[model samples]
Target: MKQLRLSGSGGQGVITAAIIFAEAAMNEGKQVVQSQSYGPEARGGASKAEIVISDEKIYHPKIVSPDIVLSLTQKAADKYYKGLDQNNGLLVVDEDLVPNIPDFPNVVKVPVTRIAAEKVGKMLFTNIVALGVLVKLSQLISLESAKKAVEKRVPPHTIEQNMKALQLGYDAV
Candidate 1:
């Protein structure tokens, strides 16, 4: 199974991203389990979404040591970085938000928020952009499946902008 954790502050869309990822994996004929946790605050409190994907049945939904962890803020990085699989895990962080990431073999730092603001004309697209980067880096789901999942999840009016953001992220790395 491939375990993934998407974490950031509330309203960052981490939960939505996890749902999109799980849908995309399911679209690709993979069994997926997604779960999330968040603080009471609606905006700035800690939030995390976990997903497990496999070709076989998923008996447990919780993630013990994630194969991949995407941290969008310094606090999330500090809290969850240690939970990544030490041997072959991939840790992706927003470079602007997390400036002091530990030196690790599979750490990828990308300016996700910057790119969303500069290229997509809004910071709201940051999560979609990050999702694209995750899809590109992990190759766990096809781009078409991810796009379809986005179309299904996002509002009709916002689909174009989100797709553009995803494409920008995919092209970035």
Candidate 2:
């Protein structure tokens, strides 16, 4: 099984991104389980979503060791990055938001939020871009499957921009 944990602020849409990723994995005939947690503060508080995917049945939903850990905020990054198995796990962080990134063998630092604001024209698209980055980095699901999930989850009018954001993230890696 491949376990992934996505961490960010509450309003960054990490939960939605995790759902989209789980849907993509399901589309590929994988067993998937997703769960999330958020602090009391509604918008800027710490948030995290964990997803487990496998071809076999998922016996346990909780994540013991994540293959990928994505952190979009300094608080989340600081909290989660230290516990990862450095030899095996890949760490991803938003370079703009996380300044003091940890030293890891496998790390991808990208300005996900800035890409959404500048390229996609709204910070709301950060999660979609991050989803694309996760798909690209992990290869857990096909990019085509991820695109289909994006189409399914996002609204009709915003599909174009969302797709653009996904591609930007994919190419960013």
Candidate 3:
């Protein structure tokens, strides 16, 4: 099984990213389990979403230790990155938002939100960008599946920009 954990602020759309990832995995005929949680606020709070994908049956729906951890906010990087064992998995963080990351192996620092706002013309597409980065880095699902999921999930009018954002993110790493 490949476990993925995505975390960021409430409005950053981590949950949506997880759903997109799950959908993509399902499109590829993989067994997937997805879940999420929010910080103590209704908005602008810390949030996290987890996905477990396996070729076989998934006995446990929860993520004990993730194979990939993507943190788009400082608080999320601080909270979630600690659980990742240095020798066990990879950590991907938004360098612009979550600065001051401790030195660790398998750590990738990308300016995700910055790229979205500047290149995509809106920070609103951060989740799709992040999802693209996730899929590209993990290679757990084909990029085509993720694009299909994005097309299905995002608003029809924004599909063009979202696909661009996804492509930019995929080429980021």
What value does the lDDT take at residue 72 in candidate 2?
A: 97
lDDT of 1 by residue, 28-123 (tens): 999999999998997999999999998999897799789999999999998898887788988999999999996677899999999999999999
Which digits, one per residue and each the tens of the lDDT, describe model 2 over residues 104-138?
78788999999999999999999999998999999
| Residues 33-113 of candidate 3: C-alpha lDDT, one tens digit per residue | 999988788789888999999999998888988899999988888888777878978899999998889566879988889
Which parts of model 2 have CA positions greater than 4 angstroms off?
Answer: none
Order of candidate numbers by TM-score, starting with the best = 1, 2, 3
What value of lDDT does candidate 1 attain over all alpha carbons? 0.93
Task: State candidate 1's TM-score.
Answer: 0.97
TM-score for candidate 3? 0.96
Superposed by TM-score, candidate 1 places the C-alpha of residue 21 at a distance from the truth, in angstroms, of 0.7
Q: In candidate 1, how many Å is residue 77 off?
A: 0.5
- Model 2 sits at a Cα RMSD from the real structure of 0.9
> How close is each model in CA RMSD to the real structure?
0.9, 0.9, 1.1
